[model samples]
Target: MNTPTSTHCLDWSSKPSFKPRILALAIATAFASELMAAQDSTTADKTNVQDDLVIYGGTYRNTATKTALSAEETPQGYSVIDQEELTMRNADSVATALRYSTGVNTELRGGAVTRLDLFTIRGFINYQNSYDGLQLLFNDWNLQPQIDAKALEQVEVFKGPTSTLYGSMPPGGMVNLISKKPQQDATHSIELATGSHSKKEASFDSTGQIGDSDVSYRVIGLAREQDSQADTAGDKRTLIAPSIDWQVSDKTLINFNLYYQDDPEMGIYSTLPAAGMFRDNPNGRFDQNSFSGDKNWNAYEREVTLLGYKVNHQFNDNWTLLHNARYMDATAYQENTYTSYLDTDMRTLHRRAYLTNETSETITIDNQLSGVIQTGAIEHNLLLGMDYQKLTSDIRYEDNAIAALDLFKRNNSLVDRNTLDMTDTIYSSDFTKKFEQTGVYLQDQMKIDQLVLIAGVRYDDYKGSESGKKYGVSTDTELTEEHVSGRIGALYQLDSGFAPFVSYAESYQPETGVTRNNEEFEPSTGKQWEAGVKYSAQDGRLSGSLVAYQITKDNVPTRDPNGSPYDLIQAGEVESKGIELELNAQISNNLMLSAFYSRQDVEVTKDNNGLQGKTPVWTPEQTLSIWANYDIYTGTLAGTTLGYGIRHIGKAQMDAMNTDTVPSATLMDLSVGYDLAGLSTAASGASVRLSVNNLFDKESYSCYDSNNCWFGAERTVEASLKYDF
Candidate 1:
């Protein structure tokens, strides 16, 4: 037996270089001087330096521009899902909340793997997420952090290559989870819910000021338990979040937040053999609710803790300083048993088991200086910022062969956990990894009458090293990367409430491994071109956007035919082009509507393995969703609300060869709610709601890949009671 040792490190190669640092400083100094010189020429009125929409009665701010700009004026495409909509849909997870959003594939791994929000954006996997305005650094491990929807104020989705404002990210897009902060007024609410699969949950939210001081506090807590869709598995979770706000002066404010979550049991991440799930089998069809793992040998547990703070200081009416930071520690462990393949009989499935232990620690910080200025009738919102992020993680994996299962005989007793071997094998190993990135960026949003112009640039540097034993082999890899990303866009607004916009953006993501020739892999880079038109009703009751985009990514990694199974080479490129449309409207005094549609085409333009021109797996060609809500205000059914929704996903390729496909599916959802106050003034602050998802039980496969098929979620019914004061 051989003992394995592993270590990884990431650091700056040498002393800080002066060229980039000087350049960044010079740009900021120039902007500051121009703004100050024009200050005396113009009044300090905010409307002269910035755009205002308060008169419209509704304003939507976004992070797409690194400043407070309404979505209609941001030039790029994005979406916002507020808390009221979340309640009406009864969304329990991030993916569920985004199910009706455009350009997102939210059911990739289906319902059993709710532990992580696995999804695709614009045909590419988007694994990075942000909290507030800062990123939650994560690695390519199984230790991802999850934030409960109950503690969030809203969810924001920004599409296309977004590295100009954010340091590094996927070409497709990114998601930002906005936490519920302390409000000026006091409020309190408590809710109890029961749902399908014996699900039970309780939660509460309380916020108010600290006596008469200039301080406020808010606390949120939740507890839930439920049986998993798969047998022999279950889900349990506990979450608590506390926050405080302090207004030291009229020009300065600070906020502190703490989040903690524990999941004693996360449902199994298992898949069924495609032979029975998709193809014909003599033993008949596989049950979507069947368990593929042993009850005594399956488990997944995780715990996460995060602490963060935000500060804002106004140095006058023209300039402000903003800073934010966060620290995170998370750990996860999973033991799973899954099928490998079907036997010749098409009924006996070969099985295997694996165990994984992962832990990670991360720190991120961002600082920015924003200024509003006017220069000869041209107003500008300028931002200059810098950010740093570091992540350290350790992961260990072990595999073992398990007894086969005969689907027709229904004999699970043949497998005995105590009799299995636990010795080291060729597939067992441990690895340690560390990564760090530093970036500086500048952006300016300029407006001259009805014309808005926005341009931004960013520079990022990354360094890392990994030394470990993987697959019974010693490995050492080192990587260093530097990239400059940028974005430019222009939008023109007309008095008729129509805006036309066009933009170009670029992104680069660092790859962390070596190629077959022992050379480090190059970073994958992407470029996108987009054009769109947005319509906003002057009354602020209706808004819509239609956009078309084309994106190309190079340096994609693919299997190396001449090397071992684990070897890879950066010799592939992919292209994705799509159109997206979204609308939100208050059709009448009591009726509201939301709808989204997306159509895309993805292809491997270049590859070493005869995969060129083939469509990628898990990427559907089209998707559509629509939701509507109605309320009765003056009738026997007064205080009653009704909601209806429909979703559809087109067929998608199941393999790189495009030899098989996952059929299309359509699902419907319904909800009803009533205020108890109608019964008596004594229940003035109480209400009840019932929601049903997948009303028809739509039985189908969500996705199929790597010789496995995932079953879609079944029909679910949930009811909740709430009280507020």
Candidate 2:
């Protein structure tokens, strides 16, 4: 890892520069335009039509006749959340922004600082986060929502198995956050916002040329403080980030970025009382004192730093080399306390304190050679590349007191210290985990008449180790697996307005853990096959896709010791089949809509414990979401917009035993906003938005963990004033 001081140095004097030249023939042409036009008797074209739109960092684009095709077109499913959508919703966290995305589940624990928010995509959990295509690895699951949404250009979710690119990941998917980069021209903005729940925030962003040179840079910073609707837990955060780009002699470009974040804490709430417990005693409240001793002391503290550098060089036009490096350090400390109320006067006191410190360093160098070759009546775009990644996770745990206690409501406090036995010593343990992966891939795109064909293949190798506090007691293992993961697809354009395509692809994930005999286990594998149809307008104002897929996982680990939950052995298989429909369109000049629906059937195909035919826990059978926005009128209400949305989650099983379930529920949200001048001081050129969430105040329970139920948000009104410059 590079030290902070070494990463900040500038070597501007050692770089080259590019110069532009003008031709005399161009000047002469301008002078003879009128004469030449009259002689030719031809009119110049006036329509503004763009045939290609580059996505910059990625091979995909929005302008391709078919969907954008990269060097390699894998069969995995992915979604992108752009900046415009983020701004419209004022997304504060990744969970909040991706709540409606298909094949994703977000779990929010009670409290501000101690929130246990988990993100699972396609049933895979990716604990590692990435920024601008670089991985951010930390041992603990402590993630800060302080990441400024305004500083991101887009959020990409890659579904299915993805170990080929990101080494150690759950079967789910990955979330990549692309940060804003410097543009060609100067752009600056200062945004101030204030809303309900005592929310206060400020953010600033600026990007422009560096001095009088062609180089450019961008800086973004944000700070926020807010109180929550929960009992006593709120949140406070601060973030600072900056990035730079240097166009050294055109062929060589350098980009660098640095960021830091700080968050104090949040709170958590206990589960809802059991059915009988709540019905027998209507006013009997589940002990909410599970966090730290004091209501105000249940807090979480964290600090994170991310530094990355990218160097791209062009060797002629057909071949280019890209080298990227990133380093991250993150640490967190959290305290949680909750009480189990057996009755009004009897309860069990529990408190947990967690601390984690982790660091990750990675470097990847890929060389791609792309060229067109003609053979008889066919043409091909061929590409070849090699990639590598190394990831390591160091985790430590401390469990102080796991004792039970009785509580007698003394002064309204949930716990009675006189009846509880406490311990002063802390028990600690440490584990260091490391993973390494490398792959080589090749792809080609063949064009024949009106049909476009795409194909690719990749070979990968992975290895890792898990070490303990006592170094010699560690275990090491290697994963030597080769599989063909690629896509075979063809696009046939029926006309300019309609086109249909079909594709087949494969994906895989590596498993991590030791077997019953203390030997490392083999990696579990998954495969998926999908077919889809898509439609889009030539003007790019509307687009939609309907897809159907079947995915299966083999070598699933099952519990070996009869009823032992900790002993896992490979004795089961699982499969999932689903269909999804999505639409994004601008119906009119002032109206827009985005909607999605998914129906899934997932089951444990075979298991030793008679779990076959059981639905997967937390996997809802169906989900639907829609959002619509419309501008009211012109003139004084020209910028006035009204937005409404609804989300529905189908009933799902809550336990592996399949004996308990959580009912399906629907939620609604409404918002109105207007942009007008001089409504009040500090309000000129500003916009005011009013929103009501959970509008009907429906007490819906999304999930329950062992009788600890979680309820959806309550009816709440929030108003915000935003000023942009």
Candidate 3:
């Protein structure tokens, strides 16, 4: 592990020198008088998997890089969860799809009750998820809206800071979900599924040319309803999305997309006391699926809608332009009885009732210009882009204390809402807030024979304002901030199919409080230095990477270790050093495997909160995961297949103090299915698969604090039947 000082001194902002010769050539090519002259070599060379599907390791356009590069050709370390992987695992959520991917820990906080995609990348939690490379937003800002897994073509995860391409994000990493687009080839599919907890689901997808007039369209929809592992907990959801692509002219193309979702049965995710989960409790331990809240008064519902559009234009073979715009709205309403306290005896827990409503609206726009040119002895791939986002939210709430409950004598009966003390319920707050951010970036990838160099820079301006009534008093607050971030990397290709790479990156995120000197605190900043080796096979059967990095974050906001909540400081620092190994291989004629391992040491070097050297909760030091699937090619079971997967998470301390520990556990999963390849024409492409998760029914717990502890998943079984045309 490199010292923290090394990361900050790497001078990641350094830029490479390029020539105006290529710029002059690019301009000449763009202004060529030939209107319909043949297409250039650079036209439509977009690294899109949808354009050319990949069954094994293949090409990809990392939105993070803004340039299409093969896995081994890129300097940054990343992971890709493709469609084949999604199908083999029968994953239905974004978190589940990336469960085996490295640098990710999807604990599924609150489990089936809340159904929020809760996870951490590296050692930090960030909400910078993107849909088709654009930020995803919800009208209801309190909860994350889970995207239907089927709607995604792939999920790309880039580890470490990426503020150079994007803007204002956590230092750990980000997840970018690529949405399925309209396909030129005609295709249609339908699937039906049933599983434990009376789970029932149906999905339909269709894509093809409307009339062969240079236009394509696609539509996808699904409906799902399922009970939970816990008593009286379940959820129902419906989703529909449609998209269209049109080549209006030889030089211009446009695409549009729309998505909507509704949830009628959202429940409060369940939680328990850390004492009852990690250590011996004065009272008896509660069962893993115990329901500790009022069942009747817990009412929750949410809805989301999104619309987006993209335009691409080619001025000539060497120059291209792209513009994308999106709008999203989300709303949520809830009235619930929630757990509020665990008494000194650890046997008594308090409850509370609340009614809340929230709504959020967001609009984003992104534009980029790309050009290909050659200067002297080097070829340059250049990209210049700009993005702007505006978000607004409204929140309202009222709450009151509710009756207490004793764990020893459990009550399964629902609590009547009318019985609560309504007098104690008063308006907590009603407010509206608006935020806006704009960013501009420039990047270039230049190649000189076996050596590839990448450099990029970005600038961002952010502003926010809040206004509303609090306790019948008008309140208002406004903030403005700006930041500059950058990155540089170099890669060398070897004759032995090995590539060595080194890179440095930086990022910044705004803080919310003022320093002790009465001036606003400076934004938190992060810097990282990484080196690694990448591998790819000429036969396209294997691809993998081994990467090591040291990252440090400064100006972290800390509560006055000895003062009140209003008293805060920002002179804190933390560092993380780790190595990650991942690989995907088509090992044999009938077998495939994917594996990953990660080891990291994250610590707070300086802090005012008395956690100077403590490791935060939920971040394990080591993790290992493997998944393998095999097909039968001979005998009567020729069309049958089997798959297995396992993941092990090391011990995680319950809190920063390390007083309690969450024991390590290994989880297992199994899947079996039969392909109808030799069946009659009508059923030729039909298939059925059965999946059993948590094969051993192992039990475990996870927590980030003493107040919020989560129980791991239990046994689950599901079967799916699908027909294709």
Candidate 4:
């Protein structure tokens, strides 16, 4: 087994904490008592499977069960962030949109890597995303596609394993982004904004029926540019989304969509040595805004285009058929120089430059048939689904050793591309990978009075092939695997709006490529056991949930102990157990609140390395967020709105051996908005908003692995002006 050098560091332990558990149990008990007393009250009608809108403040239909299920009915953890919430927070990216969600670790790379979505959920990395229930094209390389927040209607978060409906995924769960479709009602808006770091942006959205025809159209576009914290680095983006919805007949409807995004400059996305960011150095700490790369050589360019359509057909009042499909083409080119290692003096550093050009093409399709039937007192909602996905990616890259630098000196060793010699640089890799998967699934939801039971099973066949040279080695590899996933859950809804639920689910992820002996890699499998209780007020004013879950993943690939550097063996296992609490409330006609708390304990249960029983990097033990907004309804300041939020990220281990630590950090945010219509008769549909993140500008580190460390985002301010017509 390969053993990493152990260093003297923090004594942070991975044991589960009991204080939060006790508090959650006590709160649940108190709520149960109060709810039981109101059991005599009236109850709500059963959920309609076709309802795609939100129910009970925060709910969705197609996220967890592929059918309509309210927050209090679904046997899993779920959260939805609507357009209103997004606007209130001025969220521009998916990571920022999910900043306060439960069981999610956003901005693990701090504010860098804006061109990609890189974060953790339930102690596992989950960069894959779904758009309108279809998976986006993502590969192991740098070709990440970023979806604009202005084009989304809502973002839904599903926590825990969901492989029964979705084909292949991690046990941590999935994120689904709902797009903004065409509407019959005419709506037009334009927005302009400017913020710190010379940021500038403009956006527009228009939707309406086309000349009173059966078809409606929507067009959304945005342009943005901003300077980064890293010296001589900046970002520029352009995006456009167009869609059309047609009512073919009383029983059939179709929607077509096209999305295009381009990023000409995505800024430098690299890390600094831990010696200056987390640990003490002889030369003192490094600046958070330090740049370790040559500005003239750093480059990041990307483009993504996707076209898709959705169809819904109703055969009768009890049966419906739905189909969705999308094709995506994405490309990225990157050049970056990063720190390799710090010298013994802790002031001199070695660097390496890497360059890559990659392109990926992906096609995904999903078909589902849903029906409702009743036998005696039992009601059944059945769903039969089939989904297919194919992805082909081509990548070429080169790596070269770069000149060293003095950590405390200023621009003493900058590389000039015009004068530098590239004779020593070598092309390192050129490869192509193709993957295909087909999944067939069946699910049944049965309801008998207050009890709801859900059961589902899915079978997936997946294959992968790779060819070409890898670091000077020529090879051709193929791997094919098949697996069956299942899920079962039970929930009992009481008349008082209190529901208790329990569920079990299984998931599998195929590993690409082959081992040293030319053996096909085995797929990793995960299983989870989850239980939770949810409550919704009868008045629809409040909703809350408390959940506990444990997930185990096996067949994980680890480095082969006795083989060469690039060898691997599938003999590792990991376990994650956690508890989460969430609440959303409309306190009054003019006030709203949202909050969540999560704590997790993760460990490497089995591994060939000496990392067994240790916590992984970037996995924090606890996270908490609270946000509130207030609107003045009847006063001199009646047109004003105020918002405040607090977020806390707990300590985390820096290495697989559990040595070194990244200290906890707490940040504050503030926002203000006003309706300009109240100021003058001519400004009827105008409004303005201002928001500041990290209000105190607290300096902190997001993560510090043994090699690299990341600094969290500094304070940022954004102001926007919008007009509606």
Candidate with the greatest TM-score versus the true structure: 1
lDDT of 1 by residue, 99-156 (tens): 8999998867776767878678888776567888778766565677889899988889
The pairs that clash in candidate 4 are none
Ordered from best to worst TM-score, the candidate numbers read 1, 4, 3, 2
Model 3 vs. true fold: TM? 0.89
Which parts of model 3 are misplaced by more than 4 Å?
1-61, 108-110, 138-141, 412-414, 421-427, 469-475, 513-521, 557-571, 679-682
RMSD of 4: 10.3
Measured with C-alpha atoms, the lDDT of residue 441 in candidate 3 is: 91
lDDT per residue as tens, model 3, 262-283: 9877655546677766677977
lDDT of 4 by residue, 85-116 (tens): 88898889898998889999888777755777
Cα lDDT listed for each candidate: 0.77, 0.54, 0.71, 0.77
What root-mean-square deviation over C-alphas does model 3 reach? 7.2
Q: How many backbone clashes does candidate 4 have?
A: 0
* Model 3 clash tally, residue pairs: 3
User: Alpha-carbon error at 512 in model 2, in Å?
Assistant: 2.6
**Overall local distance difference test of candidate 4:** 0.77
Specify the poorest-scoring 10-residue window by lDDT in model 2: 8-17
